[model samples]
Every structure is written in structure tokens, then in C-alpha cells.
Target: MSSDVLVCQGISKSYGEGEQKEQVLSRVDLTFQKGQASVLIGPSGSGKTTLLSILGCLLAPSEGELIINSEAVNFKDKSSLTEVRRLKLGFIFQHAQLLPFLTIKENLVVFARNTGMQADDIEQRIQLLIERLQLVAMAPKFPSQLSGGQRQRVAIARALLHRPSIVLADEPTAALDWHNGQTVVELLLDQARVEQAVLVVVTHDVRMLPLFDRILAIENGIVQVKQNVK
Candidate 1:
């Protein structure tokens, strides 16, 4: 089987119409293979988030195709797009975004159940991730009761609980201290590799760039490969 898990072909995104149209992305072609972790860096308004949104299936590109696991995405079909996102993609954000009322384990369980994971399977996955992330004690605590780093660790576990083929993180360490940020990124990379998932992270931290297998930079609506370790 092909190692390629996520691909963007001639992808472009624009806003408004005709004379008022503003292009955000231009022919953004990218292919992410299994077990590869890539970090995207760019100036503010350089379309980094726009491209990530398209990759996450949260937004449709004006022109071009997004292929996930060799299947072309039908952006026009809302149900199909929903299915794609639910089944093939995992996401982490700047904030942990955990439910205030639910405990850590509850949060993970809810998401896994939504993805159709069986009760026994969900329990096993949750146990494994909780231990791997060192979130065992926090599992019974609510999000508000945990530290920022602890919360983000739970977020990582939540994202990987379903074992999605593609994992996308948007400035996941933006709110943490240097030590915590580094730890979070390291854990994310290690877990993604263990899951053999395609990992894509958007960040502005130059220090974190070298941790990824590949570095992609965006400028003036274009994406260029900055570094590749593999």
C-alpha cells in the first residue's frame, strides 16, 4: 500500500468575487506520508491556517482537490465531508478545548463513542493513552482542575483516542511555557509516530521547527519546503 496518507493537489483558496477577490492560497500542493511529522511556519496572514483548515476538511478550497487515504474529498457534500473529518482526521488546538463538566476520561470517551468505538475498545484505548500521556491521575479530574500542560496532555490523548489516519494540531503549544511547550510537542510527535499517523502542526515558534521530520514554510499564499529530514 502507498505510504501517502494525506495529499493536496493544486489547492487554492480565495475570498470575495472577481475584482474584490483575495487569494489566500495558491496551488498549495503537499503530500504527507504515514508516520511523518511536519511543522508549518509562516507570518501572520500568510495562509497557514487556511491551508490547515483545508487539510482538516473544515473548509473547502476554491480550486483543487484534497485526497485522504487515496479517496478524493467531496467538499460540496456536507455529509461526506463530515464523515471524512470524523473518521480520518484528528485535531488539537491552541487550547485544550476540553469539556468543563466532563472529567478527562469522560471527555475522551464521548469523542471515541461519537466515532463509533465500542465500549470495550474505547476503555482499552483510553487506558493506554492516559498512561502513555501520564494523565492517569488527571483522568478523574475536570479540565479546570488540571494545569495547562496537563490539560494539553489530555488533549493529545483525546485526539489520538480514535486512531485517525491524519493528526492536525494548530498552535497547540501557543499558551504554554517553554518547558511545557517543548514537552507537549515531543509527546505529540512520539505518539503520532507510534500511531503511524500523518502529523501536521502549525506554529510560529522557530525553536520547535527542528523537532519535526519536515518543515514547510508559507509566504505570500504559497507553500515551500524549507527542510526535510527523511
Candidate 2:
């Protein structure tokens, strides 16, 4: 472990106002160091996903400050938040969310291209990710041709292709069976360690707990840390 990659101080989130108000998260503080992988688990509607979203910079916290790479980000500024997300963070959702019209390899490259990356550099990164994620054989295939596990693997590859310093995965294996779900999580954990990325995953699957360096439980908007099989 090295310097803290992400830090949240007194983070809180709420929705609506007055009679329609909904409080999803209470004051929460967290720190994640490089190469650390954490799994956040909670019951349905327990605000685990909300916390994940705040951490990923997808949703601004109703209150508190977020420091990324030792700098406090102003979520109120869309451009600042967008730039931080683009340069430092990677996100994975429950669904693979691959582009149906493109080949597996193209799906990965298209995203890099959108960032105006050099064509040769993009190709090199794609091949590297494909090999690391063991997606070489499936590169030529389309999303529809892949199994659920395969697609999720590709999603993992796509999220990491940019070599992000922080990765936020929200229920990434929720769509797969036991075998495949475990496989996908294992791959994510392994890859995060290899890249020395700060990975935070939100999931209800307790089976994936042992693989994480730490586990956090959320309930009634409160966050509790649990020491795991690190």
C-alpha cells in the first residue's frame, strides 16, 4: 500500500426535500490506498450503490469533500468532475453494456478513440487488455455471440483499458451464475492488484467477500467496516 488514491470525508447523500425527502447515506468517511480492493455489501436499498456512485464521481455527495489523487475535486463544476472521471476513474456496472454494433475489440477501441487517442496507441492498449483478460479468442466476436461471462470479462477489459487509477464496479457479477460470477470477480480482483489500482466494488454477493482485501457493510445509511481475509 502507498499513498491514498481516494478519500471521502463525512460524505452524505440525500434525495428530494421536505415530505418527499429520502436520505440514502449518512456521514461516511473512507480511504482507499493504491492496490487495495474493497467490496461493499448491504441489503437491498441500503445505499451501497449510492455510496459507490459518489465514490466514482457519477453522483455528487449531498455533503462532504472528495479527495482524489490528493486533490479535492469540486463536483459542482461539471468540467472538473468530467475531467477527473475521464483521467483517473473507471466504472463497471451490473450489465456488461457493450456496444452491440461493434466487434469485441472495436468496442474497446471506440472508447479510446472518443478520447482522441492515437490509433496506434489505441491498438496496442486493446491488444494488451485482450491478452491480460484472456479475451484474445473472443476479440473478433460480437457482444451477442459471447456468453454472459464472456461479455462481463470484456466489460472488465474495457473499463481497465485506459489504465485508470481507481475502478468502481457496481454489482458487476449480478447477472451471472455462481461459477461465472465468481470467475468475473476473481479476474477483476487479480487485474486490480496487477495494475495497483484502487478498486471499490458494490455487491450483495457475499461469496465474493473472501477475495477482497476489506469489506464494508451498509445499513440504515450507516457504513461499517469489516476486516476481511486480506
Model 1 lDDT, residue 205, Cα: 92
Residue 72 error, candidate 1, Å: 0.2
Clashing pairs in model 2, backbone N/Cα/C closer than 3 A: none
lDDT of each: 0.93, 0.89
Clashes of each: 0, 0
* RMSD of model 2 against the true structure: 1.5
What lDDT tens digits, residue by residue, belong to model 2 across residues 84-164? 888788888788899999999889888877656689989998988889888999999999999999999999887787888
Q: Give each model a TM-score.
A: 0.98, 0.95
Per-residue lDDT of model 1, residues 114-166, tens digit only: 99999999999999999999999888899999988999899899889899999
Instruction: Say which candidate scores most in TM-score.
Output: 1
- List runs of model 1 lying over 4 Å from the truth: none
